[model samples]
Target: MPALPTVRRLSLAGLALATTVAGVSMTASAKPPEPAELSAAAQVNRTIQGMSLEEKVGQLFVLFAYGPDAHQPDARNTTLYGVASPAEVVAKYKPGGWIYFDGRGNVQNPTQVATLSNQLQQAAIGTGLHVPLLIATDQEQGVVTRIGPPATQFGGSMALGAARSTADARTAAAITGRELKALGIRQDYAPDADVNINALNPVIGTRSYSSDPKLVSEMTAAQVQGFQRDAGITATAKHFPGHGDTVDDSHTALPTINHTLEQWNAIDAPPFKAAIKAGIDSIMTAHIVVPALDPSGDPATLSKPILTGVLRKQLGFRGVIVTDGLEMAAVRQEYGDAEAAVRAIEAGVDQLLLPPAPAVQFNAVLDAVRSGRISERRIDESLLRILLLKLKNGVFFEPYVDTAKAAEIGPAASLATAQKIVDKSITLIKDDTKTLPLSNTPRKILVTGWGVSTTQNLANSLAKRGAVTTVAQTGAAPSDAAIAGSVAKAADNDVTVLLTRKAWDSKVTDKLGKQRKLVNDLLATGKPVIVVAVQDPYDIAYYPAAPTFLATYGYAAVSMESLAKALYGEIKPTGKLPVDIPVAGEPQKPLYSFGHGMSW
Candidate 1:
């Protein structure tokens, strides 16, 4: 939102070089050295060589945005949004790139995505800079996926982690990477390395892998390898130092992590460190406060002690450091416009994501450099990293698909992969008394709870597997109809399968007191009450009364399909619970711990 500082002075040679590099022809008689006409490496070298202190500092600032507005006839939204197009931000922004929160138009298939990305890269190349942009998205899978539809949708980080096998995790990542690459997306802001430490953490619930750092580390590595090494997309390990423990959402405000530095190092930092060691290209900073790490009490985005001292110096992460989002409450509410950008850069962050207005922010960064608020050398450091990543990703040299070809790919691969993972990851936790493997005979079954039936068609696949009567509920609260239906179904049905889909969120905990009462009441009927959790395994704590309990970790269509198959004995329940579902409020911890599952 602030203007960049003006260039104080450039040597005659530097001006000539910049002009020449910009492709402005000079007279033969007065030809300055064509330093800019050199190769990409040469241009970078020349730019670094010719830069006035101010020009170099401006390079570190990266603006964030959604897709370019297709509504504008002139297509002038590029400058306004900080990206010429959604894809160009990643291809041209290079080491510093845009973090996309939302996009214009539809992103339902891989082909459209690929075409959009190809166009984006073309714009970057046309800019005359060899460096590729670092395009990023928050594709955590399950509840969060930027490229949905035709793309296969894995349940979530936890669902993948529940599979426990690194192979499974890697396969999921590889699938994600392949789909992303097909669509022209190069950066995946995923494999959320956060361990879900608190049940009340309103944002990171299903997004996180597990509360166990070791499991999170393994899954993070697998995902990184799958996206970067296998699929040729850069993977970012995010919300560092870890955001799983916080009860607040950074999008609205800063959350505090009260753990001591020792605790964080032991519990939270391992997954991030593992991701970095696994050659992850970037690490996204969380807008959270770790009072133990930064006693001054600033969010990690602005905390030098955390960003530079801990993540850089101690952890030795040499990759690009990205801020979560500049417009987030933690940043916007705390610092003024120019100051936020300056502090983040000085704090060692390589990119500023989703700034309010990119062009304005870019100008402000330029101004900051001129004013000596941000050092030119600091800018060079980030720019170099970005260029290096572009080189590594082969963006400068590789040929990408055009828009037409991209449209043809669709999202079939993604959907198929999602279906596979869901089929493999759904586990039957306990089927005591052998209530599962339901009879093929027609029988009325009551399916009640949140996410049971939605416009998304989550329950459609399940209904095809057996005779199912569906009832929709909302939130953590169980509906009266759902409760009454469960009771009524138990009274007359040959079998009663009370499928409770808990809506996943940071604010909701495992102990569903009201829902538990309903399950207990259904259990009182002395009929087979099979409680299926189409969300987190933690919900099992609420329905201990049920003879059979299942954890699917998601309510996506694929998950529902897989759950249906498992119920009919079409597939074995070999998947494990990825996180510890603590018992009620006792905090006995581990009603069913990580890696615990039962075979059919």
Candidate 2:
């Protein structure tokens, strides 16, 4: 959105003299070109053609803030960037986008978030840059949600996958997108397109839709439409070529996938293809390496063969391609600070996200363009995509939001929609003792488990149902003393409802052993034990002897309400398993096949 190049203006006498010298008639051939006649793409090209080398490089970066205010600095988080405040950083670097992380003090309430976004935008525009800054967040809901209460916390992709309803998927996306747009955030890194085929995947368990590529494809396409067409915010289908099969977290270590070219085409490629067909404006690259696609051992973020060859040529996606955080160990496995940005751009990625040293990365790429290692045309290709997306998503015209109005939206109605999604996704995977549909409304219950918020929410939900509820203080990874204390408390309760987390994983040896033991010991007390798996439903496979079990896909508040209502038979459980759960020691055998659900 830089200023359009204009013809020189002449004074009245000079205009008459020039017109006489030119000897042109006052006709169509003599009419000057108007800005309104330019195509959107042409205007974007002019904007890119008008940028400085520094501004063009700035257009390719999306950095996260550590401080709270635009002009004020935070002392607690000073490690990532220098001591510059958020506004100061924007003025200095002029990043094309700014992403918020609540853990870094960049986001708080709706009004505060809106104010911060406006301040960032104001700073960027103040630098004589005509295009508005793209504000974003990882509001994927479920576990990775950055915003707090008052914003709708939808059960993420796996919940929609479990429900197996594209309407529900679209609804989830629309609601979350509305909340984001209201807060002046124009983009969301959500609708995770990875097929969660590996049950033990450490990073992308509930983030992905399902193990089946067809289901992922349907949900991915629906979400793309919801986010772009319905909600008017840019949706990024992320972690390309599948991050769902890895056991290692990319934040800490590098993980490699051995899926053959055929396997990738069948498993990982479909969701992206569907996304492209659905007109997804942004595609985030995976940091993991796919040996079958590229035997050169480069991760997809740096591999030109994977990003350019397969994604661009084979799939024909002309949208903006973004990289995962360059600070992550997966991208940093081979290269360091400066070269990562240069190589990622060389690989056809349009945006470089959250590299550790933004200044170093920016200068290196600028120098590369000057040294002829990377062409200026290559940079313009990326800028064209970015600018067109900005124009498409209404970022240029409507970058600001009413801070007060933003605080009012996405609270009641959006939360109801979010709960509706989770409510439909509560899968009753096991019921051996018919312990559900409790006849006595005032039954004594113990809510214990991995997620403290979920446990407390479940306690609140059951209490509303007239049950005397007791919540144990055991953390997710509990100690033996805490488990023993919870067991002692279970003797008084009529039914002990406990939660268990990840159990079936090769990398994790402990495997939620204490949570499993807590459930068994609770059952030994002659109390009806209702176990709910918050994250991976495979948590129940470790405790095969349990009488009653359920899989909520996630531990969102709505899931707890669904669990409470299903327990009392107020509403029937209609959800099915999105993935197959294996027995404790057998990875190949299935304990409960996909689409397994029981109802009264």
Residue 20's lDDT within candidate 1 is 44
Candidate 2, 202: how far from true, in Å? 0.3
Per-residue CA lDDT of model 2 for 389-438, tens digit only, reads 77667776566778888889666777777777788888898899988778
List ranges where model 2 is wrong by over 4 Å.
1-42, 76-79, 505-512
**Looking at model 2, which ten-residue stretch has the lowest summed lDDT?**
19-28
Clashing residue pairs in candidate 2 (N, C-alpha, C atoms within 3 angstroms)? 70-87
Model 2: lDDT of residue 599: 91
Task: Encode model 1's per-residue lDDT on 404-520: one tens digit a residue.
Answer: 545544356656756777777877788788877866776666555555343125446556765755443433566566577657756775555555544333245324455666777
Model 1 ranges off by over 4 Å = 1-40, 47-96, 99-108, 125-132, 357-360, 408-418, 452-458, 466-528, 588-590
